[model samples]
Target chain A: MENYIPVLLLLGFAIIVASSILVLSWWLGPKKPLAVKLSAYECGVNAEGSPHAPFASKFYLVAVMFLLVDVEAAFFFPWALVYKESLQLGPILFVALVIYVAIFALGLFYIIKKDCLRLR
Target chain B: MNTVDIAILVAKTLLFYLIVLHVVPIMVWVERRGAALIQDRPGPNRVGPFGLLQPVADFVKFIFKEDPIPTGANRGLFLVAPALILIPASLTLAVLPFGDKVKLFGREILLQVADLDIAILYVLAIGSLGIYGILFGGWASGNKFSLMGALRASSQVISYEIPLGLAAVGAVAVYGTFSLREIALAQDGLWFGWLPRWGIFLQPVGFWLFFIASFAETNRLPFDLPETEAELVAGYHTEYGSMKFGMFMMAEYMNLTTISGVMVTLFFGGWHLPFVADAMLLKWIGSQNLLGLVQVVIFLTKVAIFLCVFVWVRWTVPRFRFDQLMRITWGRLIPLGIVNLLVTAGVMLWLGGWK
Candidate 1:
């Protein structure tokens, strides 16, 4: 955890730098608030309706798929760290890795078969 | 930590902060000038020699320009979004080891700002958070184009992130550690007394996968569907003006630099010159501090080359269609990454566990 101190300090420095720039820009920038200028850009014509309309369910499907795969990928990190040592010991760990990946590959194939990735 | 340790820490943090800050404008200049070169025109020669000062001029313009909050926009998220993006981009520098340790003030000081045990994990976690800036910026703007852009950007980032993580996993398995410094150190020396023992040689497929995924992660051309000017009208930041938009631009370039740094650390021998051992260089240089400085220059040179490749690709390739972008990551890259990981593990075992 001591290793994380510099990371925290770096984050603090970044926050200070980023916020200061935003403040500088806000302070120096002109603020002319004509109704036309303040309105959302729509090329030229006025924007109609709320921008919060429902989007395609495919996007939600993609998010769900991402969660599943990302968690699996996260698991690989710890396994990856120990993999070389485990292989040196025996083939058990290597076989286990293959099985784990095989199961995940099955899930990936299912995702592909369902066509969740198709943007059409 | 003692007072001296604290001071050293503060100095390293500031140094890295300045490096990331400087890289943004330099990248902006390179992008414009490189684009012009490819298009057969003189690019921004009016501002300083070869438009070197164009970024400075651009910064001044951004500060004085009119900044307006769109009438129906979410006031709070709109303001917080840019800083959210910039912070992560800058923070990633903490784990990147610029050079070997230098002896200074009668102490051995590591060149990295933070040498975490979980450095690779830290990078991956911070990198994923950057998408929120684009998502919030787009959603808060309450413009149709911005919303569409945010949706596209979020999904795209999340999808490509799988292949990116898998590629990193391949590196970790080969090096057998999550710390980036160890990975870089492991790449030292030679293979068969001829080739440099870089990660590229051990995991060639992983390198290519990582290289391609990084382009998508940074949202550069070909994968820049989120901010495609033709359709989305500047996409996520369409409603932002002045320095808020500037922050987003800075964040993009900073992310590019960070990704490039990570690539060099992981795949290309971090601070190690190709085929030249550190001890040999140390003998020639005859000073630890001087050797450290030379290593830093070497690391930066590698990163600069990668940055040039990024700029070159941006101008050379046309943008990918949204469906095609999604298809490539999902249909092609992810499967390839998995196969690559398995094959690497199998080969490592066959070669008697990556000595």
Candidate 2:
């Protein structure tokens, strides 16, 4: 817990420095809002729809795929750290990793096959 | 722990902040000057000494400039976003070792701010949170383009992060430790009397994957779909102006340094140089304080070179289309990263396992 003092201190320093800049700019910088300027930028035309409108499912799919792949990748870290130790226990760990990766690969293949990753 | 220990820690943390902030202006100068050199033009020479004062000038401008929050924008979130990005980006620097230690007046001072057991995990977790700054800035802007930019940045970050983790798995397999200092110490000796026992030498594919993934993760050129002015008009920070924008920019450069520092710590031996053992240098120097300073210099030099590479790659490569970026992350880099992990495991297993 003592080791975390510096981390917390650094965090405090970071926040102080960052917020000081924001506050400085706020205090010093001029502010004069116009409707034309306040409106969302849209290449000179008025914005057509709400900014919060739903986007494509491709984006959603990409995010979901990230979850699947990222979690698998996370699991790999501990496994890698213990690979040598676990290998001494038996070849079972190696076989388990093989099966794990195979399943992951199969899912990746299926995703690719379905074109779930494509933007359009 | 004690008065001296607390004092040293405070001093180190202060020094780290100063150095990182100092690097921001230097990096700004280098990126502009380097980008100019790449594009065959003179860049910012009119300001103090080859545009050294250009960042100062920009800072002044940012301070005096008007920062108008849009009519429909969420003012609170719009104001908070830059700080979100800046803090996390700077926070990751706490765990990275610039040098081993200095023996000062019968006491020892560690070069790093913290030596946490979960240093790498801390870095990954904090680094990922940096995207929220972009997300908030985009969403609060009340702009279509800003939202698009936020989506792009978040998705790109998430996609590349998988490969980045996998790449680290290979390195962890080699080192068996998450502490950056321990990893650096492990690479102190030469591999074959000439070659350094660096991660790059042992895990070439892992290094490559990490390098490329870091590049993408930083939202740099060739992968800067988040901020491609041609499409989303300055991307996530479209509505931000003045120092709010500067904070984001500062955070970006800081993130670059953080990533470069991590790469150096992980793959390039941090402060370790080829064929020159620290013990030999320490003996020659005869003063641990001086050795610590020298080690810090060497570590900074390597990070500086990589930062230049980041700038160079930015100016050289064409920006990838969003789809291509995603496909590369999902298709090529991930599988290769997995393969690298497996091969590294297999070889380490065959080579008597990790020591």
Candidate 3:
């Protein structure tokens, strides 16, 4: 736990450095806001509608897939750490890992076959 | 811990901070000059010798330029997003072991900001948080392009992260530890008295998977679809101006440096000189402190090479279509990463462990 103190200190240092840079620029920077300049940029044309317009559902699908795949990746970490030691359990541990990965691999294949990742 | 220990800790943290912070300008210089060299153009030669002062000029320009919060932009989130990205990128260096320990003032000091047992995991956790910066910047800006960029960036990062983490797991399996320092130390010595026992030799597939995933994670080209200038017009930071934009640029370079450092520590033997044992170096140098300094130099040299490769690849490859990027990660890299892990485990098991 004590080993983590430097990480906190580094985070604090980062905040200080980043904020100072922002503040320095904010102080020195000119503030002149024209209606045109302040408008949302749409290739220099009059901004059409709200920029909050709906996007495709493929992005949301990616997000959901990320959650499942990311969790599976997380499960691999502990197993990886103890893998060397677990070799003492003979081929049983390797077989379990194979089964675990095969399940995820099958899911990945299903996602592919469904063409859920198609951007268009 | 005593006062001396606390003081050393502060010094070590500051040193690592300065190293990561300074890499930004140097990399900016390299990226421009390197691009010019590749394209046969002079590139920023008017500013200082060999355009070395271009980053300084950029700094001044960013500071004095007008900053506008676009109409309908969320004031709070827009302001916080740049720092959100910068902080996590900077904090990752804390867990990287730049070198082995050095005896100072009768006490041994490890040449790392933090010696966490779960250093690699901590790095991944912090790295994943960087996506929030892009997400917030895009959503807060109230711009369609920025939102598109943010969504793309988020999905790209999260997708590559699976392979990245899996690759690291492969390293952990090979080294039998999660601590970056231990992994580095384990990589010392030679195999068959000829080849260095580096992680690359032990886990070659893991190395390639990690290296390729790192390009996506850092948003470097071929994988830089989120910020494709022709398509997205600077992507998630389209509405950002002045220092906020500068912060994003700085954070990108910082992430590049941090990722490169992690790559060095995990797969390239950290600070170990090839075929040159630490004990032999200590005896040759006749001082532990000087040897520590040498190790840091070695470590930074490896990191510098990786950084150059990043810039090189950026100019060499064309940007990937958004779909292609996602397909590569999900359809290819992730499965390859799993296979790499299983193969590593199988080999270790076949040999009854590397010990």
* Top DockQ model: 1
Candidate 2 lDDT at B35 equals 95
Off by over 4 Å in 2: A87-92
Residue A48 in model 2: lDDT? 84
**lDDT of residue B125 for candidate 3:** 95
Pick by DockQ: 1 or 3, better one: 1
Q: Tell me the tens digit of each residue's lDDT in model 3 across B6-63.
A: 9999998999899888999999999999999999998889898998999999989999
Note each model's CA RMSD in angstroms: 0.9, 1.4, 1.0
- Residue B84 in candidate 3 has what lDDT? 97
Assess the local accuracy of residue B340 in candidate 1 as a C-alpha lDDT between 0 and 100.
96
Evaluate model 1: give its TM-score.
0.99
Instruction: Give the B-chain TM-score of model 3.
Output: 0.98
- Give the clashing pairs for model 3: none
lDDT of 2 by residue, B281-355 (tens): 988989888999999999999999999999999999999898889889888998898888778867776776755
Candidate 3 residue B91 C-alpha distance from true site, Å: 0.9
Candidate 2 CAPRI grade: medium
